[model samples]
Target: MKYLVREKMFSIGDDFWIEDEHGNKAFYVDGKVLRLRETLVVQDPHGRELAVIHKKVISVRDAMTVERDGEVLVTVRKKLFTPFHDSYRAELASGDELEIRGDIIAKEYDIEYGDERLARISRKWFRLRDTYAIHVDRDDADPAMLIAIAVCVDRLVEHEHEKHEHEREQHER
Candidate 1:
């Protein structure tokens, strides 16, 4: 399945929708504002919450948590960065691990469990500059969970980008 996500859809308080390849609304992202930490709730069209993605305010490394039915589903955090690529680690509640590696700043990457690819996240397939598509490659993949993971990855990347920009400005001052 392919889901299209708007790149600018991460404004802390601004809401947006993830559309299917056929252009039908697939999921709604409700951005929560004025909170101590960033929070986004992914819901179905009928308004039932599917998953919640929120930042961990007290983590040593920048981290985000994904929850379903109010239970912690997984935690995603930056593992490291290289000149050519960036990496993130996802620890699932069931003791499984997933690794995300790629040119994340450019919105291109893959979510993998061991050697198997679960989903491919990319923007090159889209014509619109602000639109990117999340392609779930595995038939057993959970579309909503994968979408929430993509949302978390984007927010984490942006958070790091803004922090670095701020540091650069501080040195320039």
Candidate 2:
């Protein structure tokens, strides 16, 4: 299944609906405000929360957790030593690791479990430039979980980008 995601989700309290390829609302991103840490809830059209994505402090590196019903489903952490392409690892609660790799800032990447590809996120399918697609290639895969993971990585990348920009501006000051 392929879902279309608009790139207008850059800030806290920004809410948006992600639609399927058929143009029907599939999931909603509810950004909760007035929280000490960033939190986002991925909900179904009927408003049932499926997963929660939020920032995790106290870690050596920045990390985010994807939770379901107060349980940690996956914790997304950046690989500290990537000198080439950007990457993140989704540590599943079931003790499996999903590798996220490729040009992340461009919204082009692949989520794979060792040898199998679970989903691919890219802007190559749409000409809108601001919209990207999440194509889940496996029937056994949980789409919401994958989507939440993507969001997790996105927030991390955006935070990193913001930090870099701040440092650059400070250097020039």
Candidate 3:
């Protein structure tokens, strides 16, 4: 079944928290809408299959985090994408984590960000400074991937500051 995906992009914000169904509170992304899936297979904490609802869920109202330098930076809204058998990969930088999303993961790749090598490819990568958001070809990326990349662009200034600080430290030594 096909569903209509909303346009309220979700990303890491200052205040974010996620509460589980059991009233347990966790860090969730704020200022973003969650994309829900059409079918939800809710399982109990004990791993027992609980309920399956045939619903039209376009996004998941959940929070996702990528760690960098032992710091939790951005909180991403979880939107479950239907796995397309054919799709290219796109890499994004969020503070210190380089999130790559696609059908096939490209590990050990270099991200050329604003004339600087940002991060090494993997499930995660170190976010580099001095990165700029280049115009990515729409044909080359999916909507969700584009959203992730746009978030990275938002953090480019922060990365630049970090890069400058590191350079200054080197000169001091």
Candidate 4:
């Protein structure tokens, strides 16, 4: 199923509404305020938390963890020095590793487990800025997990771009 993730504007903390293809609000991503590190909680319409995503504090590479019920489901880390495209490595608690590759700047990417494509995230399908669609193969992946992964990936990519821009400004000064 494809869901639309629309980011909120003019908010101190990041907030998003995940909508179904019919434009019905399906899930809500609440970015916790006043945290040392970035953190977000995904909840159902009824307000029950489905998953929690937070940046890893002590990782050498940019990393984030997804958890449900205090159990880590997966850890996603950015792959440095990938040629031509952005890459990420995800380690699942089940010992299954996945690779994510695509144009992160354009928000077009796929999550793959070996040869199988588990999920696809893209903004090309929508005309609205800051809005993207996440398509998860329900037969191959859990929708909630994939959505959380997309959220983490989006934040990481944005953070990296900002970091680069800051460094560039420093160099120009």
Candidate 5:
């Protein structure tokens, strides 16, 4: 199954509409601003909350957690010192671990379970900015969960990029 994730620009905070391959709205992402830590809630089309994502504090590495019904479902942490591609580790609630690595800057990446690829995320498929595509193996993955992960990864990467840009500006001054 394929879905298009598009972020709405010029809003008070991050907001996204996840659309199916047919362009029908499938899910809604409501980003909570004015919070201590970054937080986002993903809701189904009918407005039922599906997952909650929040930044993990007190970690040496950048990390975030996905929760459902107040229970931790997955914890995603970035691997420091990746010389080549950006890499991340995701610990699932089922005790199964997954690896995420690829061209994060270009938004082309894959979520893999050992030797099997469960999802592919890419921005090359769309020409518009702040938009990307997520193709998942429906038989092997839950679309909602995968979508939540992708959203969290995107936000984290974007936040890091903004921070670096600010630091660069400060250095120039």
Candidate 6:
């Protein structure tokens, strides 16, 4: 189904995950507003007018839930990022900056019984077991910092695992 917000005519595509108010998960060819773009009017560091935006999109492989405020929430999957559960909070900070292109929009299409149907008609949908995006600012806060921290934590976890594995091997030998 297609829904028009403002003047933009959006068509929901094929792969979408939906979670209702009751906490039940549903998959849609293109889920309804599983993702959205919120535009921010701001001035750059140099005081130039710029359109800062945060496109909150859901992950592909994880289940997601939708709140009454129309916000989509997804869990941190282990495969997407190591030590995925290092922190329980998933909300992006105010100064976080997201990397995305002007044309980077989510899309999906489905084929059923050799007949293609629009699973999502221009609305966003969440993906079961997928990551989500939250755009912030590029000021004092940096998204890369969080990513780096997460990476470091993952490495540490891996290092511990490897050490244990090595000890096990030695014992066996």
C-alpha RMSD of candidate 2: 1.0
Residues 75-162, model 1: lDDT tens digits: 9988865565689988999999999988788888999999999999999997898999999999898999988888889889889999
Instruction: Give per-residue CA lDDT, model 2, range 1-173, as digits (tens).
Output: 99999877746899999999999999999999999899999999999999999999677889999999999999998987899988899999999999999999888899999989999999999889889999999999999999999888888988898999999999999
Prediction 1 global C-alpha lDDT: 0.91
Model 5: per-residue Cα lDDT over 35-125, one tens digit each: 8887888899999999999888777767889999999999987777788778887899999988888987788999889999999998888
Q: Scored by Cα lDDT, where does model 6 land?
A: 0.27
Query: Which 10 consecutive residues of model 6 have the lowest summed lDDT?
Result: 1-10
TM-scores for the candidates: 0.96, 0.97, 0.22, 0.92, 0.89, 0.23
**Where is model 4 more than 4 Å wrong at Cα?**
7-12
TM-score of 6: 0.23
Runs of candidate 3 with Cα error greater than 4 angstroms are 1-142
> Which lDDT tens digits does candidate 4 get at residues 1-173?
89887643313286767898898899888889999988889899889999999999988878999999999999988887887778987889999888888887788899888998898989899889878889987565678888888878877877788899999999999
Q: How accurate locally is residue 50 in candidate 4, as Cα lDDT from 0 to 100?
A: 94
RMSD of each: 1.2, 1.0, 18.0, 1.8, 2.0, 19.0
lDDT of 5 at 12: 29
In terms of TM-score, how similar is model 3 to the real structure? Answer: 0.22
Query: What are the lDDT scores of the predictions, listed in order?
Result: 0.91, 0.93, 0.31, 0.84, 0.83, 0.27
Which candidate leads in lDDT? 2
Q: Could you arrange the candidates by lDDT from highest to lowest?
A: 2, 1, 4, 5, 3, 6
Q: Rank the candidates by TM-score, best first.
A: 2, 1, 4, 5, 6, 3
C-alpha lDDT of candidate 3 relative to the true structure? 0.31
Per-residue error (Å), model 2, residue 145? 0.5
Candidate 2, residue 29: the lDDT equals 95
In TM-score terms, candidate 1 sits at: 0.96
Deviating ranges (above 4 Å) for candidate 6: 1-140
